[model samples]
Target: MVSCVALLGGSYDPVHAGHVALAALFADLLQPDQLRIVPAGDPWQKAPLQADAADRVAMLALAFEAARLPIVIDRQEIERHGPSYTIDTLKNVRATLGPGASLVFLMGADQLMQLDSWRDWHALFDYAHLGVAARPGYSLAAASLPPAVAAEITVRQGSLEQLRTTPSGRIYLAETLAVDISATQIRAALRDDDQASLAACSLIPPVVLDYIQQHHLYKN
Candidate 1:
């Protein structure tokens, strides 16, 4: 069987339950030889990150500590200054793992909707297969995606097995993810200490929540 490595990348400003769930879901399905969590250094598209890189990495460590899959916190993007781009990261990983290794880069459906806007988005397929997780209200249908992105995913969509066997250029859509959580909302709740909203959602991991409070994060 071909060796596979699954990568989950995000700002992970405070690593919440949804991030863990998305990673866990793919880990269960792909069962890749290795799982890596990539925290973005500077996400050009988003606002300035609330948590610093060290804090974000610390939170990721705590969040995925209990996960069943072996996890590696990849700091390539964080180490490289300037805007973090997926295509660049993918290229670096592909070079390190070599051509024979099957690499699947995971993302949420919301990211898929804006796929066309990423730098050299089309070249992403040249480096690794995409494993996108769908949440409530996010559709994988072509009509929901940008015309260019839809065209690519439409013809490249494949089963989990095929994604595992293929080296690159495949798309796997996993709709099993039902939790729809966002980092922006989590940050807002933390900033306000809105316990009621946080409790109602129950999407932030206790350990992560504790870490955030202990470090006095997002209290601006």
Candidate 2:
């Protein structure tokens, strides 16, 4: 059987339950040999991150402590200079894993909607297969996606087994994921007058909440 590695990359500003759920859901379905959590160092398209690299990485560790699969915290993007791009990350990962390993890059449907804006977006499939999870408001319907992204995914859609077995160039969509929390909302809540409101929301893990509080993070 081909070895499969699932990569979940994000800023992980505070590492919330939604992020953990996405990884857990895919881990159960793909049963990949390894799962890597990649925290972005400098996301080119987004505003500055509220939490620094170390804090974000630390939060990710705390959030994913209960994960069943072996988890790796990849800091290549953090160590790399300049803006972080998914294509560059995938190229480096592919080089490390060689040609036969199945590399699945996971993301939400919202990201898929803006897929065309990513640097070298079309070439991403050359290095890894995409495993996209559908969020609450985002639609996976052909009419809901950009023409290019919709056309590309239309032909590459495959089963969970195919995602686990294929080396690259396939798309697997998981439509049952109901997670809808956003890091922006979590950060805003952390900065609010009532910090307890964030805890009540249950958007982030308890351990992560502890870390944020202890670190005095996200205070403006």
Candidate 3:
């Protein structure tokens, strides 16, 4: 039987270390039958990502190749002509997984803070469970939040074992994985030919680093 899975969606704008770290940690905690890495084609909430869909997918595939974990490159939104809503992505995964499969939609703390602003945010809960990752130096307190976000939460706690039973998308506190890295910093370093910044950056997966060197990405 195919198992319930967790869905991690993003632009993967450049598929940085933070993205990979979340994938690794969540895979460990959820122990999903499978973990789908769905990269958005054109995210509506955020600006259009710098990397194209094909490149982003290739980079992610390379980054996760060592583990051989089942990472599906879901392109439902990429195919669509308009904005990519989380609800749409969730709906597609729900259909693929069926009713028995428990799906979790993963997001960072920043996304959760603006959860109320998402289109049909409440409806998304019907499709999958949620895994809200902690941002660097972020606290997951629900106090002072709008009732919609606060009451709807299924806060997570306890050991990895408890994670499976926890409500979806409830705040899941995690140590900063892959360190504090940003796509912008990586791009800047690439532009300036700054070896120190590139070396210090926690953004690139080693394989991705090699790929960047070979392809000379971001050379303007």
Q: Against the unseen true structure, what C-alpha lDDT does each candidate score?
A: 0.88, 0.90, 0.71
Candidate maximizing lDDT: 2
lDDT of 3 at 205: 83
Q: Please give each candidate's TM-score.
A: 0.95, 0.96, 0.86
Residues 1-220 of candidate 2: C-alpha lDDT, one tens digit per residue: 3399999999888788888888988998999999988999899999988889998989888888888888899999999999999999999998988988999999999999999999999999999999999999999998999999999988999898888887899999899899899888888888886757566447889898889989999889
Candidate 2 stretches greater than 4 Å from native: 199-201
- The CA-based lDDT of model 1 is what? 0.88
The parts of candidate 3 lying over 4 Å away from their true place are 144-147, 154-178
Per-residue lDDT tens digits for candidate 1, residues 1-220, read 3389999999998788889898889889998988888999999999999899999999999988998967899999999989999999999988988898889999999999999899999999999999999988889888988999988987898888987877899999888898888888888777665568667336788888888889998889
Top of the candidates by TM-score: 2
Residue 5 in candidate 2, Cα distance off native in Å: 0.4
Question: How does model 1 score by TM-score?
Answer: 0.95
